[model samples]
Target chain A: MHAPADPAPLPGDRRHPGWIAWALLAPMVFWLAAFVVVPAAILLVYSFCERDEVGGVVFRFTLENYQRVFDPVYLRIFARSIGYAALTTAICVVVGYPVAYTIARASEVWRHRLLLLVMVPFWTSFLIRTYAWITILKQEGLLNGFLQAMHAGGGPFNLLYTPAAVVIGLVYAYLPFMILPIYGSAEKLDNSLIEAAYDLGAGPVRAFSAVIVPLTMPGIAAGTLLVFVPAIGMFAITDLMGGAKVPMIGNVIQNQFLQARNWPFGAALGVVFMLMFVVTYGLLQRRGARLAG
Target chain B: MIEIRGVTKRFGSFTAVDNLSLSVRAGEFLTLLGPSGCGKTTLLRLLAGFEMPDEGVILLDGQDVSHLPPYRRSVNQVFQSYALFPHLSVRDNVGFGLRMQNVPAPEAAARVAEALEMVSLREQADRLPHQLSGGQRQRVALARAIVCRPKVLLLDEPLSALDAKLRHNMQLELKHLQRRLGLTFVFVTHDQEEALTMSDRIAIIHRGRIEQLGAAGEIYHRPRTPFAADFIGQANLLQVAVVGRNGTTARVRVGGGLELTVASAELPAGARTALVSIRPEKICISKQRLDTENLFEATIEEEIFQGATDQLRLVTTQGTRLHALVANESAMQEAFHEGDRVYCGLHLDDLVIVQAE
Candidate 1:
């Protein structure tokens, strides 16, 4: 008796959006403007200012702090920080990938339990956890005592207060972050694609490099950035574990603000760090987009 | 050429593929057609060396390939999702297999170009897979699979993701490509229409067994099992009584006292049980109500106009229902009106008698 009803439930074609979309997006715009955009603007302004006698930032215009950031003392420190972060990131990828892949391909019941295990360590405060590491790795700490109980010849290996200890701590802290995103990407990887690669005359190594690695690149990129960027600016680990022996860029910047009493120099360093983030993020985004396209 | 001998795959306790045996002649176009969960895809993977059968042997060109790893086999598969490298342009994706084989650079480029031309995608070689439409991506996948020219090509529902019109075009294009290249194809799909339209031979699978394997016409017209008859086409399966038999032919008494003969190898000697099947189009409908030897009176319960043809569901005088399909039904008017009296005839040769149980 009546004509058939229209099947399409959505009102407008996606090509043309309506006012409701803009309304829904308002809150996101407000959040980004309040936190991210405003902070970046303040940092930019502080970068161009001069420091007063008491380390309070003065509004007087000056490019002196920016010029001083290029000094050899600071540049060498910056390079060392980058080198350490890069090494930590590389280690995390090599160590985290197999664990993540195993967890992803596991049975359903075990997968949830395994994911919980990965997340459990994060419930405790990160600083407290770092302190716990100091207790374990320090001289006459659990590791050294245990080594001595085993009748080890060397009195105690100076395992703590070294660059290696800093890396170990960083790798331990950020490993789960590296694992989770790569796990997501690897879990969604279609199994047939791997079979196709193998069917087309690719050896196991070739299939992994050509198909699996490329397919899961987004996760690898995400994990790399997650570990590397944070490791670069981690002043706490350097102070606690590196025994304040190594002067990383992060330590230098922190000293400028609180110890050295040079707020403008610290502001300049913060701005440079933020700019480095932008460059690294832009390059990674382009690479991911190229792969997806 | 590929041969699967008594291959069986079991997942824990449940069997995915029963002990199945079939062969693919060189340059033959074969399809494994079935419903979902019917194990056709499992069989394809076995042939591709992705899964090792629990008990069986696979031979390619008279050599035992059962123990060979997937990479060592001279075969390639076009995955249902296309599996185009998201990181690579179309040219690189298509050229991947050739590169793996260590072919010379110029030869690989030439072969990739030839393969791309075959799919009419040479112009889009520089574009990524996502940059192309779904149909174009499908052709790109086909080009990638064919570039290696392996001994066998396995396709797992390759065109199923495309829209209706594009699917039709791709079906024809795939058949043409298969013939031109003379490559053995082992396609898997649940679409019976696609199987009938494109395949030189169809292995109708059900559950974990191959119910029947023959040419398309043979499988459609001379269905060996009730499942095959119901799956391949619309059949008016009416309960009937086998009144008599003579050599290869048998006379069956259907509902409403209609009698028909069918050529079948086996039929129990009894008038109590049998199912006589006839294609909907095999029934002749008339409005004038003439008396014929093979006649049945009915009333039209529903009539549906299907553009080119009208389908009528009728109830007989004895309250038994039957469906009839009329081609170009616009001009053939009258008794197709709802509740109008009609008489129909069933072609004797078209009648197929299957076991009732």
Candidate 2:
């Protein structure tokens, strides 16, 4: 056995033994090891196991669950879910950017009031808010009733239980996520830089595109990640507003556990879903770094 | 040439710039010198079209540009922070204004290269603003503003951020650049030394009005107002009562009943109560009473050695405090100590009669 040379300690670490530091970190370490690491290890192990006939774990190793996760039916559902999430991110950006910019540029009094308004939706339960949207958007809801009352020449249109309704719900739920981050970036932007641009002969449109957009890009990237990742895995809005008519990846993964009682397949799907997130996030980080450089 | 007439800019109840008027001659380096919140920066912003004057007309080459936006005006400003785009390279930052004018790529590139060469930053053109040192960034800002060849350039204390030594060097370089380009330069700064070194004419502003506007020597030696006298350089403002007037000069009695002669053309007509402004350097000190037009005996209260000169605080026999600066030359090797009796002499040409206000 060989003893390694002791490196110099940090500035304030000389008085305390190394074990004291570990003892101080024990609670956080235990919580992560118990909740996160242990669950991930279990999921990885179950992903390769087989299920018994009575919907219990057989404890036998197999690759069949992983193979079933790549079937055409489930792959299409994953693609549809990604497409919807991308569209929701785009819509949120388009609608939230101007609102965030306005709030950031407003006077201090108005800025705080407007920020409070943006966060008011978070005070209530998200499920209750989605249910409220249902009443306003359904076929016989307030919109259709108002249209019928005006004696319009068309029948009540099917507004809910569609892709448009799903997108609307996702955008509404995730808009504040977009606004808050972008506002943070916009608020810290130096006004003198804009004035410098105009003084250098750039018009208003040119200044906004050249100076403003590139400066606020970090916030846009952060907001996109905040809205896109969870939206792909969302099941509540699809079930309520989308009527669950079209199968999404979330709907299928949720059904595998509850209705089919296929725990191994569900574990496999979850592992694959987590892997997709890792890859997507890795790509976005690379792109963000490149843009910054 | 730029001319501002009756410019009054008010922000709500506070008037930042009062009814002020100034004419910047062609190719002249005029500095707006004042302390903070004296509306010197507001006047610069007005010329840059960042702020519209409440009542005034700004004429560039005899054409009204008061209502024109900053982009539309043929003027550029070098902000105090440099305001260089952090994401862009030095070359791109310098070439931004030309690109805005729809200049062709090759021409804009050549102009950018020339401007960079002028500032001696050709090698670091590919680096961003953050990568450059403070002085290098300031030069880039200068290059950026001058590359467009605007009729006028407004600089709002652009050299205040640098260290003292670098600021002195940049001041010389900026003066050389301004003279070579022959563009009207309107600079704003509270530093009197910088104003005296770089400006052809200095406009001392105070409380939203121009107290005095003239060449550096005139403003320093003969300030018409007390504010200008105190703001420009160190001055001993002695309260005096006018005894009589004598053809462009006035005889005034100091607090100690001593009479002195000073130039009085700037003083208000028939003014009895007046103030006499005298430069500290003008008063000479000696061990014996020297033969001079105005002589006074005082006790040296304190002596501050400042390498090249010694600032002596003297209290006259009548209890009037006065400051006299003596050169630390070899001929005057005998140093004056505190509480020593000394004779201070003031020349006739060194004093100016100013308004009591």
How far residue B174's Cα lies from its native spot in candidate 1, in Å, is: 1.7
DockQ of 2: 0.33
Checking candidate 1 for backbone clashes, the offending pairs are none
Candidate 1 C-alpha lDDT tens digits along B1-357: 788899899999989899888998999889999999999998888888888899999999999988788889888899899988777898999999998889999999999999988887777789877677788888888889889988999999998998887798889889988998889999999999999989999999988899999999988887777888889988888788777778777777766776666664556555457777778887888876655436778888999989888898988887778888987644546536788888887655677765643
Give the worst 10-residue stretch by lDDT in candidate 1 chain B.
B263-272
**TM-score of chain B in each prediction:** 0.93, 0.96
- Candidate 2: which stretches are off by over 4 Å? A1-31, B246-249, B264-269
- Pairs that collide, model 2: none
- The DockQ-based CAPRI class assigned to model 2 is acceptable
Computed on C-alpha atoms, the DockQ of candidate 1 is 0.38
Best by lDDT: 2
Predicted model with the maximum TM-score: 2
